[model samples]
Structures are given as structure tokens and as C-alpha cells.
Target: MSEIISDLNTIDKESIRIAKKYKQKNKNAAGSKEGTFTKIAFISISLIFVVLMLVVPLISVVINSLKLGLAFYIESITTEYVISAIRITLLATVIAVIVNTFFGIVASWAITRFNFKGKQILTTLIDIPFSVSPVIAGLSYIMTFGRMGWATPILDTINEALGTDIQIAFAVPGVVLATIFVTFPFVSRELIPVLNAVGTDEEQAAALMGAGGLTIFRRITFPHIKWALLYGIILCTARALGEFGAVNALSKTRGGTFTLPLEIDALYLSGSADSITASFAVSSILVIISVIVLILRNIVEYKVKK
Candidate 1:
């Protein structure tokens, strides 16, 4: 009993010491006020220009989007082509997000939860899309899939073998493929750091608790990184919605290539002033979508952290 009391005293004394030390560190030391002011001044100055440049352009986009009137905005937002493009873009983005979510979980699990050959190389390969130009990204697909390209004969043969005509170029499927390729890395990269932080111990512990793979993943893994997953999904959706270079690169730029972006270009090139305004109107719609996604992501991430 005496030893127990002594131990309690020692712990209390140690805690008190720590609290005092922390207080001192946070106290107004001799030069801390000046140093603090200097740091604040430097950051304020540096961020001033960044805020001006970034915020002004963003505000302009929003202001322009709203300038055309609520009825006009509603009509613009609900127009047949705009609606169809939104549907197409959302469908492609959702499919890509789903595919990449699985890949993110699998790849991060494989990278961190196991060891294998050429792991570093695999990691580097995952980052290739980030460095590659969207234009070149589209070209690589074209080189493999276009009419005169290497795999065209194979595609043709397969279509004949199946007793059906199949054309991939300048179509919805091509746009989807481009979206998937470009947005592949977002979720995986987002999850890597989160997975690294969570580590394998909880996973192992779940196994010891008689949890199966699905149970282990659901109960132990998913919650830890759900925010990151959502962040990646929102970002990927935004990128896919705004994707222009790759879609333009692979598409025929005619009938089958009538995406909202392409339509905007065509309208601006040959149509009247109203069509040009409609182009900006479409752009303004996309910009609004991107902004909403970003705001949702911010809220979700902040809540998760809290």
C-alpha cells in the first residue's frame, strides 16, 4: 500500500513537472514577442499575393456564372446537352472512382502490408500519369487503338469474330477510358499516406480477433482513410469533369465527339454571339460543379479530422 502511494506521488510529480515545462515554453520569453511578430509578418506578406491571385480568378468565375440570371442559370444548368454531358461526365467519373477505389485499397495494402520484388518500380509506374501530358496520355491510347494504329487490326478482327461492328474511337467509351487513365492515381496516392500511418498492426490484431478479410478491412481499415478516399474521389471527379486535352486528342472532333467541351469549341468557332455566350455558360456550369465538390470535400475532411 505504501509503495502504491509512493508510485502515485511520483507520477503526479512527473506530470506537474511536464505541465510547468510546457507552460514555460509557451510563455512570453524575452524575444518571443518580436520573433512571433516577424514570422506573422513574413507569412502575411507571402500569402497576400497568393490570396489575391487565386481568390480573384475564382471569384470571377463564380460571378460570371451568376451574371446570366437564375432562370438563365437554371436553363443553362438543365439544358439537354448540358444535362447529357453532366450525366456522361458523372457516369465516367463514378466508374473511374469505383475502379480506382479498389485499386487504391489493393495497391496500398500490397505496398505497405506486404513485401515483393520491383515494388519501388510499381510505385513509380503509378505516378506516371501525373507526369505525362494529358495530350500524350490520349495519344498513347490512340496509338494503340486508332484505325491505322498497331491494335486496329486486332480490334477489327475481334469485331468480325464477334459478328458485330465495334468502334471505340471518337465515342463515349473513349472519353471514359481517357478519364479512367488520367484519374487513376488520385485515390491511391491519397490512401498511401493514410495507410502508412495506420500500419499493419491493427490489421494483424484484427486477424487475431478472428476477423475475416472483409471484416478486418471494414472494421479496421476503411474508417481510418474514408476521408482521404472521399477527398480523392472529389478531386478525381473535378479533374474528369474539366478534362479537355485528352478528350480532344482522341476524339474525331465531329459527330461522335460532341461532348460539352467539344460542343463549346464548335459553337464558339462557327456560331453566333449567343452560342459563344452559351460556351461560357457551359464552362460556368462546370466551374460551379467543381466548386461544390471542393466545398464538400473540405467539409468532409474537416469533420473527419475532428
Candidate 2:
């Protein structure tokens, strides 16, 4: 009992000494009053610059959208083609987010929880989408799936065998594929650091108790990264919603493959004042969706901090 008491006293003394040293270090590192003023001024200028460039444009879009009145905005979005495009965009976003979320979990888990050959290469491959151009991604799909594409023979054989004619390029499926490629990295990248920080201590202990892989993941891992997962999902959804270059490269531009962004571009290019108004209305919708995503992101961040 005395030894335990003595040990506790020693620990308390060591903690106090470390705390004092930390305080002294910070005190020495703190800048002078003029330097503090300069820092504050720099931060304020940056904030103002961001607000002017980014916030003002969004506000302008909203204002112009409302200028035509709520009725025009309503009629614009309610048009058949516009509605179809919105539906297509939503579908692509949903599918991409779901597919990427699953991939993110599996890929991040493999990268973080295991040591393997080519681990660095695997991580680099996962990040390729981030640096690759979306246009290139779209063209790659076209080259692989188009009528004269490399896989054309395989696709033709399958169709012939099944007596079914399947179209991929210039189709909804192609748009989804492009979206998936562009958004491949968001969720997994977001979760990697989180999983690394969390480490495998609890999972190892759970395994020692004979827990299965899925059981450990569900009850142990998922809860730790749920917020990060949600954050990544929101970011992926935003990117998918805004994806234009890749989808445009593969889309037929009319019939059924047009997404909301494509429709907006078409409307703007039509050169009619009403079409321009409609474009603004659609832009406003996208802006609103983006704002909602930002809000959800903040909520997730707050929860994660807690």
C-alpha cells in the first residue's frame, strides 16, 4: 500500500513538471504584439477574400434565380426534360455514393489493418482518381466499352449468347461508371487516417475472444469511423452531383442520359432569355444541395469531435 501511494506521488510530480515545461515552451514561442496583430490582419483579409469570391457568387445565383419569381423557378424545374435530368443525376449520385462507401470501408480496412506486399502500391492506386482528369477517366471508359472498344468482342459474345443487345457507352450505366471512377478516392482517403489513428488494439482483443471478422467490424470498427464515413459520403455525393466533364464525354446529351449539370449547360447554350433563367434556377437547386451537404458535414464534424 505504501509503495502504491509513493508511485502515485511520483507520477503526480512528473506530470506537474511536464506541464510547467510545456507552459514555458509555449510562453517562449508566443509572438510579440505586432506579430499577433499581423497574424490577425492576415487571417481577416483571407476571410474577406473568400467571402467575396465564393460566397458572393452563390448569393448572386440565388438572387438571380429569385428575380424571375418562384413560379418561374417552379415551372422550370417541373419541365419533363429537366425533371428527367434531375432524376438521372440523383440516381447516379446515389449509386456512386453507395458503391464508393462500400469500397472505401473495405479498402481502408485492408490498408490500415493489415500489412502486405505492395501495400504502398495499393495506396497509390487508390489515390490515382484524385490526380487523374475526369475527362481522361471518361475517355478511358469510352475506349473500353464503346462499340469498337477493346471489350466490344467480349460484350458482343455475351449479347449474342444471351440474345440481348446491351449498350454501355452513351448510356446511363456509362455515366454511373464515370462517376464511380471520379469519386473512387473520397471515402477511402477520408477513412484511412482515421482507421490508422484508431489502431487495431480493440479488434485484436475482440479476435482473441473468437469474434468473427464481420462481427468485429460491425461492433468495433464501424462505430469508430461512422462520422468519417458520413463525411466522405457527403463529399462524394457533392462531387457526383456536380460531375459534368466525365458524364458529358460519355452521355448522348439528349434522350435519357442527361444529368442536371448537362441540362443546365444545354439550357444556358440555347440563347433564349427564358432558358437562361431556367439555367439559373437549376444552378440555384445545385447550390442549395451543396449548402445542405456543407451543413451535414459540419454536423458530422461536431459529432466526431464530441
What TM-score, computed on C-alpha atoms, does each candidate reach? Answer: 0.79, 0.86
RMSD in angstroms between candidate 1 and the native structure over all alpha carbons: 8.4
lDDT per residue, candidate 1, 18-105, as tens digits?
A: 9998888877574699898999999998799878988777777556655666676566656676666666667767787788878888
Candidate lDDT values, in order: 0.78, 0.92
Write candidate 2's Cα lDDT for 42-102 as tens digits: 9999999999999999999888877779999999988988889988999999999999999
For candidate 1, what is the TM-score? 0.79
Clashing pairs in 1: none
Scored by lDDT, model 2 comes in at: 0.92
Root-mean-square deviation per candidate: 8.4, 8.7
Instruction: Please identify model 1 stretches exceeding 4 Å from their true place.
Output: 1-48, 65-79, 208-210, 253-256, 269-272, 303-306
Inter-residue clash pairs, candidate 2 = none
